[model samples]
Target: MSAQQRRGEPPPLPEPLSPLIDAHTHLDACGARDADDVRVLLDRAGAAGVQAVVTIADDLDAARWAADAATWDPRVYAAVALHPTRADALTDDARAELERLAAGPRVVAVGETGMDLYWPGRLDGCAEPSAQRESFAWHIDLAKRTGKPLMIHNRDADAEVLDVLRAEGAPETVIFHCFSSGPEMARTCVDAGWVLSLSGTVSFKNARDLREAATLIPPGQLLVETDAPFLTPHPYRGAPNEPYCLPYTVRALADVVDRPAELLAEQSSDTARRVYGL
Candidate 1:
């Protein structure tokens, strides 16, 4: 059995100290495959004090599903993009369809897109880094054209990703989703007026760099996410993650920044709304 199964179902966290938003997640990946699945998951989140969540899609089929999923539930919004590793899928035909889905109602951001060097030599059959870089630039342009926030997914390619953003001149709103860099990177992003969206990984006991980065972002530039079905927070590190698991990360971030949990939630939610225009 998986660790999560051996441990049994994950339990609910205490109700959030204030309203919060999950800046990124993938409802489809979380086993919320349809409206009913989405509702069941979202209801759990609502009861836990999460007011909204953005379901991000990393491929064309999932992008279509994500755009539709956003409309299926009132509290769920969407962000559509080709994940960097899947950059090879961004053919002319895919690009056309992505543009259409990006403009779909309730699609709030353009991302989970950026360079990810974690899988060199086609790990998991990923496209090469050159292809990933090409795709990242195209997505950046789409964000500008769509007038949506650009949500980036940087993995072991911080310098390269940031360089592309600088070279291409970023869209008006840029956010580094699931930020995994250090305090220096955090300061650099904030200096560039980009938002840093923290994920459950921040709660890991060994995440000292992440903790220090948390201290660098101003409240206005800070946001949080679950990156569900992955990066499940500590104390439940191996548990199945869903939107309801967000409070753990929020509480963790609140502690690291030495801010009141409620105030942090309030501000982070506000930042999410402004960044995504939700």
Candidate 2:
């Protein structure tokens, strides 16, 4: 879907099931600019059975925003880090600030960090592989020190990401956010005891491998997210996404894993809570 199409009207909320948590989202990107906006957005989500959301940071400014956003509501939590694409901006001062934010009580993970090889030469200002690797290692260390989960963002660099995690010594809890790899990678992550957080991508018609991978995840290691304002579930593929749209993805995932939607919803929320320490 085109960017314009994806930014169009928000999809209608799906039927409410057991309460679920949007393990990852971007409230700032979803037009939540203040405490009131945050409450409104989350209220809509609550109506659709989404009980909580973890807003993730992709840059220094966003990390600051996410940390404070968490204080705006009880249901909101935060994950702070520089995205791999923006690893070039992780200067000393930025790193110091991120260290502070990552230790915040409301900040639950050090994340949205890893390798994004898909954007290097193709996207302007994308970080080089070396810089991305260095930043990812730093974030992993922060997660370890803070006793929080490491939330990873891997795109077309699964092998490299896995290698870096192994070399650097991964945190006790590691989550592969928006996991899009095939079953082989999925199995690797599962075997390594890493959590795989699926997004609306799993609901796409062409995501056969992702659907198959979903079936491999044990309930304890599985989580769900909207990755909101992007990757809206199918039938609303090109529409604007928000936490309220999460049930659509959950129902879709249920079909993929051959589990009842309510059971999957509870399991995903429980796994999210345990991994994030919510």
Clashing pairs in 1: none
lDDT of 1 by residue, 1-278 (tens): 45665675774555655589999999999998789999999988988899899999999988999999999999999999999989999999999999999998699999879998988774877978899989999999999999999999999998999889888999999999999999989989999889999999989989999899999999999899999988888877777788888988888887888988888889999999888888
On lDDT, the candidate that comes out on top is 2
What is candidate 2's lDDT per residue for 1-278, written digit by digit as tens?
A: 65556668778767887679999999999999999999999999999999999999999988999999999999999999999999999999998999999889999999899999999999999999999999999999999999999999999998999899999999999999999999999999999999999999999999999899999999999999999999999888888899999999999998998899999999999998888888
The residue-level lDDT of candidate 2 at 215 comes to 94
What's the true lDDT of residue 254 in model 1? 79
Worst 10 residues of 1 by lDDT: 9-18
Score residue 117 of candidate 1 by CA lDDT: 92
The Cα error of candidate 1 at residue 241, in Å, is 0.6
Best by TM-score: 2
